[model samples]
Target: MVDFGTAEVTLEMVQASQIGMKALGAALAVGMTGIASAIAEQSIGSAAVGATAENRDVFGLALLLTVIPETIVIFGLVVALLILF
Candidate 1:
Protein backbone atom coordinates (compact mmCIF):
# COMPACT_ATOMS: atom_id res chain seq x y z
CA MET A 1 0.00 0.00 0.00
CA VAL A 2 1.24 3.44 -0.99
CA ASP A 3 0.08 6.48 0.92
CA PHE A 4 1.53 9.70 -0.45
CA GLY A 5 -1.51 11.95 -0.60
CA THR A 6 -5.13 12.33 0.30
CA ALA A 7 -6.61 12.78 -3.15
CA GLU A 8 -10.26 11.87 -3.36
CA VAL A 9 -11.78 10.34 -6.50
CA THR A 10 -15.32 11.30 -7.41
CA LEU A 11 -17.95 10.17 -9.92
CA GLU A 12 -17.44 13.30 -11.96
CA MET A 13 -13.76 12.52 -12.15
CA VAL A 14 -14.45 9.05 -13.43
CA GLN A 15 -16.96 10.34 -15.95
CA ALA A 16 -14.51 12.92 -17.17
CA SER A 17 -11.84 10.25 -17.59
CA GLN A 18 -14.21 8.11 -19.63
CA ILE A 19 -15.08 11.04 -21.85
CA GLY A 20 -11.41 11.77 -22.36
CA MET A 21 -10.77 8.16 -23.30
CA LYS A 22 -13.63 8.19 -25.80
CA ALA A 23 -12.32 11.39 -27.35
CA LEU A 24 -8.86 9.92 -27.60
CA GLY A 25 -10.25 6.81 -29.27
CA ALA A 26 -12.23 8.90 -31.74
CA ALA A 27 -9.22 11.05 -32.53
CA LEU A 28 -7.01 8.03 -33.09
CA ALA A 29 -9.57 6.41 -35.38
CA VAL A 30 -9.83 9.50 -37.56
CA GLY A 31 -6.14 10.38 -37.45
CA MET A 32 -4.89 6.92 -38.32
CA THR A 33 -7.39 6.47 -41.14
CA GLY A 34 -6.58 9.87 -42.56
CA ILE A 35 -2.90 9.05 -42.51
CA ALA A 36 -3.52 5.72 -44.17
CA SER A 37 -5.66 7.36 -46.83
CA ALA A 38 -2.97 9.93 -47.52
CA ILE A 39 -0.33 7.26 -47.87
CA ALA A 40 -2.52 5.24 -50.22
CA GLU A 41 -3.47 8.30 -52.26
CA GLN A 42 0.18 9.34 -52.59
CA SER A 43 1.10 6.20 -54.44
CA ILE A 44 -2.13 5.84 -56.35
CA GLY A 45 -2.11 9.47 -57.39
CA SER A 46 1.41 9.24 -58.72
CA ALA A 47 0.56 6.16 -60.68
CA ALA A 48 -2.62 7.75 -61.97
CA VAL A 49 -0.71 10.82 -63.12
CA GLY A 50 1.79 8.67 -64.92
CA ALA A 51 -0.97 6.68 -66.57
CA THR A 52 -2.85 9.81 -67.57
CA ALA A 53 0.27 11.27 -69.12
CA GLU A 54 0.88 8.12 -71.09
CA ASN A 55 -2.60 8.06 -72.57
CA ARG A 56 -5.31 10.63 -72.24
CA ASP A 57 -7.93 7.94 -72.82
CA VAL A 58 -7.02 6.39 -69.48
CA PHE A 59 -7.70 9.60 -67.58
CA GLY A 60 -11.16 8.60 -66.44
CA LEU A 61 -10.07 5.25 -65.05
CA ALA A 62 -7.02 6.76 -63.41
CA LEU A 63 -9.10 9.45 -61.82
CA LEU A 64 -11.51 6.87 -60.46
CA LEU A 65 -8.72 4.80 -58.98
CA THR A 66 -7.11 7.83 -57.39
CA VAL A 67 -10.37 8.88 -55.78
CA ILE A 68 -11.13 5.46 -54.34
CA PRO A 69 -8.81 5.93 -51.39
CA GLU A 70 -10.92 8.87 -50.22
CA THR A 71 -13.62 6.48 -49.10
CA ILE A 72 -11.32 5.36 -46.29
CA VAL A 73 -11.50 8.83 -44.83
CA ILE A 74 -15.27 8.74 -44.92
CA PHE A 75 -15.22 5.40 -43.17
CA GLY A 76 -12.87 6.81 -40.58
CA LEU A 77 -15.19 9.73 -39.99
CA VAL A 78 -18.05 7.34 -39.40
CA VAL A 79 -15.99 5.34 -36.94
CA ALA A 80 -14.97 8.49 -35.14
CA LEU A 81 -18.57 9.62 -34.90
CA LEU A 82 -19.56 6.27 -33.50
CA ILE A 83 -16.82 6.49 -30.93
CA LEU A 84 -17.74 10.02 -29.95
CA PHE A 85 -21.47 9.47 -29.79
Candidate 2:
Protein backbone atom coordinates (compact mmCIF):
# COMPACT_ATOMS: atom_id res chain seq x y z
CA MET A 1 0.00 0.00 0.00
CA VAL A 2 3.06 2.25 -0.09
CA ASP A 3 3.13 5.08 -2.58
CA PHE A 4 5.67 4.53 -5.38
CA GLY A 5 6.68 8.16 -5.41
CA THR A 6 7.36 8.11 -1.67
CA ALA A 7 9.41 4.91 -1.66
CA GLU A 8 12.96 5.22 -0.42
CA VAL A 9 15.96 2.97 -1.11
CA THR A 10 17.78 1.58 1.91
CA LEU A 11 21.52 0.91 2.26
CA GLU A 12 20.87 -2.80 2.62
CA MET A 13 19.12 -2.88 -0.72
CA VAL A 14 22.08 -1.23 -2.39
CA GLN A 15 24.46 -3.71 -0.76
CA ALA A 16 22.36 -6.65 -1.91
CA SER A 17 22.36 -5.39 -5.46
CA GLN A 18 26.15 -4.98 -5.33
CA ILE A 19 26.52 -8.57 -4.17
CA GLY A 20 24.33 -9.78 -7.00
CA MET A 21 26.38 -7.87 -9.55
CA LYS A 22 29.58 -9.32 -8.12
CA ALA A 23 28.18 -12.84 -8.48
CA LEU A 24 27.21 -12.14 -12.06
CA GLY A 25 30.70 -10.86 -12.79
CA ALA A 26 32.21 -13.96 -11.26
CA ALA A 27 30.03 -16.22 -13.36
CA LEU A 28 30.95 -14.32 -16.49
CA ALA A 29 34.66 -14.54 -15.72
CA VAL A 30 34.52 -18.31 -15.37
CA GLY A 31 32.22 -18.84 -18.32
CA MET A 32 34.26 -16.74 -20.73
CA THR A 33 37.51 -18.35 -19.64
CA GLY A 34 36.07 -21.82 -20.14
CA ILE A 35 34.91 -20.93 -23.61
CA ALA A 36 38.27 -19.41 -24.49
CA SER A 37 40.09 -22.46 -23.18
CA ALA A 38 37.93 -24.75 -25.29
CA ILE A 39 38.57 -22.72 -28.42
CA ALA A 40 42.31 -22.61 -27.81
CA GLU A 41 42.47 -26.32 -27.08
CA GLN A 42 40.57 -27.21 -30.23
CA SER A 43 43.14 -25.56 -32.48
CA ILE A 44 46.12 -26.62 -30.42
CA GLY A 45 44.94 -30.21 -30.28
CA SER A 46 44.64 -30.42 -34.03
CA ALA A 47 48.09 -28.97 -34.53
CA ALA A 48 49.58 -31.16 -31.86
CA VAL A 49 48.10 -34.28 -33.43
CA GLY A 50 49.54 -33.32 -36.80
CA ALA A 51 52.96 -32.68 -35.33
CA THR A 52 52.91 -35.93 -33.37
CA ALA A 53 52.07 -37.79 -36.57
CA GLU A 54 55.07 -36.23 -38.30
CA ASN A 55 57.45 -37.14 -35.47
CA ARG A 56 56.79 -39.50 -32.59
CA ASP A 57 59.46 -37.74 -30.57
CA VAL A 58 57.38 -34.55 -30.63
CA PHE A 59 54.61 -36.08 -28.51
CA GLY A 60 56.04 -34.71 -25.30
CA LEU A 61 56.34 -31.18 -26.65
CA ALA A 62 52.91 -31.33 -28.24
CA LEU A 63 51.35 -32.43 -24.97
CA LEU A 64 52.97 -29.58 -23.13
CA LEU A 65 51.70 -27.10 -25.70
CA THR A 66 48.18 -28.51 -25.59
CA VAL A 67 48.04 -28.31 -21.81
CA ILE A 68 49.29 -24.75 -21.72
CA PRO A 69 45.90 -23.37 -22.76
CA GLU A 70 44.27 -24.98 -19.71
CA THR A 71 45.94 -22.42 -17.49
CA ILE A 72 43.43 -19.86 -18.74
CA VAL A 73 40.60 -21.74 -17.05
CA ILE A 74 42.55 -22.05 -13.84
CA PHE A 75 43.21 -18.33 -13.83
CA GLY A 76 39.54 -17.65 -14.51
CA LEU A 77 38.53 -19.76 -11.56
CA VAL A 78 40.87 -17.82 -9.36
CA VAL A 79 39.44 -14.51 -10.56
CA ALA A 80 35.91 -15.75 -9.96
CA LEU A 81 36.80 -16.75 -6.43
CA LEU A 82 38.29 -13.35 -5.79
CA ILE A 83 35.17 -11.63 -7.08
CA LEU A 84 32.88 -13.78 -4.96
CA PHE A 85 34.94 -13.41 -1.80
Candidate 3:
Protein backbone atom coordinates (compact mmCIF):
# COMPACT_ATOMS: atom_id res chain seq x y z
CA MET A 1 0.00 0.00 0.00
CA VAL A 2 1.25 3.47 -0.82
CA ASP A 3 1.02 6.06 1.92
CA PHE A 4 -0.43 9.45 1.06
CA GLY A 5 1.15 12.54 2.55
CA THR A 6 -0.95 14.54 5.03
CA ALA A 7 -2.00 18.08 3.95
CA GLU A 8 -3.40 20.88 6.10
CA VAL A 9 -6.71 22.41 5.00
CA THR A 10 -6.94 26.17 5.34
CA LEU A 11 -9.87 28.60 5.15
CA GLU A 12 -8.48 30.13 1.95
CA MET A 13 -8.22 26.71 0.35
CA VAL A 14 -11.83 25.93 1.29
CA GLN A 15 -13.07 29.23 -0.15
CA ALA A 16 -11.07 28.73 -3.32
CA SER A 17 -12.50 25.26 -3.79
CA GLN A 18 -16.03 26.58 -3.28
CA ILE A 19 -15.46 29.26 -5.92
CA GLY A 20 -14.16 26.68 -8.36
CA MET A 21 -17.20 24.48 -7.77
CA LYS A 22 -19.52 27.40 -8.33
CA ALA A 23 -17.80 28.22 -11.62
CA LEU A 24 -18.05 24.58 -12.70
CA GLY A 25 -21.75 24.53 -11.88
CA ALA A 26 -22.35 27.69 -13.87
CA ALA A 27 -20.45 26.34 -16.89
CA LEU A 28 -22.37 23.04 -16.80
CA ALA A 29 -25.70 24.88 -16.63
CA VAL A 30 -24.93 26.91 -19.74
CA GLY A 31 -23.20 24.17 -21.70
CA MET A 32 -25.88 21.53 -21.10
CA THR A 33 -28.75 23.86 -21.91
CA GLY A 34 -27.02 25.01 -25.08
CA ILE A 35 -26.58 21.39 -26.18
CA ALA A 36 -30.20 20.56 -25.39
CA SER A 37 -31.37 23.61 -27.30
CA ALA A 38 -29.33 22.59 -30.30
CA ILE A 39 -30.82 19.09 -30.27
CA ALA A 40 -34.38 20.41 -29.99
CA GLU A 41 -33.78 22.94 -32.76
CA GLN A 42 -32.44 20.27 -35.10
CA SER A 43 -35.72 18.28 -35.18
CA ILE A 44 -37.95 21.33 -35.11
CA GLY A 45 -35.98 23.01 -37.89
CA SER A 46 -36.27 20.01 -40.21
CA ALA A 47 -40.01 19.73 -39.66
CA ALA A 48 -40.45 23.45 -40.03
CA VAL A 49 -38.57 23.42 -43.33
CA GLY A 50 -40.69 20.58 -44.62
CA ALA A 51 -43.91 22.24 -43.58
CA THR A 52 -42.88 25.55 -45.09
CA ALA A 53 -41.94 23.85 -48.38
CA GLU A 54 -45.27 22.04 -48.58
CA ASN A 55 -47.33 25.18 -47.92
CA ARG A 56 -46.07 28.74 -48.07
CA ASP A 57 -48.89 29.86 -45.78
CA VAL A 58 -47.38 27.84 -42.94
CA PHE A 59 -44.07 29.75 -43.15
CA GLY A 60 -44.91 32.06 -40.25
CA LEU A 61 -45.91 29.23 -37.96
CA ALA A 62 -42.91 27.20 -39.01
CA LEU A 63 -40.62 30.10 -38.26
CA LEU A 64 -42.11 30.40 -34.79
CA LEU A 65 -41.66 26.71 -34.13
CA THR A 66 -38.06 26.73 -35.29
CA VAL A 67 -37.27 29.69 -33.04
CA ILE A 68 -38.95 28.22 -29.95
CA PRO A 69 -35.91 26.09 -29.10
CA GLU A 70 -33.75 29.23 -28.79
CA THR A 71 -35.52 30.12 -25.56
CA ILE A 72 -33.73 27.27 -23.82
CA VAL A 73 -30.38 28.90 -24.52
CA ILE A 74 -31.61 32.18 -23.07
CA PHE A 75 -32.78 30.36 -19.96
CA GLY A 76 -29.38 28.73 -19.64
CA LEU A 77 -27.66 32.10 -19.83
CA VAL A 78 -29.90 33.38 -17.06
CA VAL A 79 -29.15 30.36 -14.91
CA ALA A 80 -25.41 30.77 -15.45
CA LEU A 81 -25.63 34.40 -14.44
CA LEU A 82 -27.53 33.46 -11.33
CA ILE A 83 -24.96 30.84 -10.42
CA LEU A 84 -22.05 33.18 -10.91
CA PHE A 85 -23.59 36.16 -9.12
Question: Scored by CA lDDT, what does every candidate get?
Answer: 0.94, 0.97, 0.92
Report the CA-based lDDT of candidate 1 relative to the real structure: 0.94
Off by over 4 Å in 1: 1-4
Q: What TM-score goes with each of the models? A: 0.94, 0.85, 0.89
Q: How should the candidates be ordered by lDDT, best one leading?
A: 2, 1, 3
Q: Candidate 3: which stretches are off by over 4 Å? A: 1-6
Worst lDDT 10-window in candidate 3: 1-10
User: Evaluated with lDDT, which candidate comes out highest?
Assistant: 2
lDDT of 3 by residue, 1-85 (tens): 9655697788999999999999999999999999999999999999999998999999999999889889988999899999899
Query: How many clashes would you count in candidate 3?
Result: 0
Better of 2 and 3 by TM-score: 3
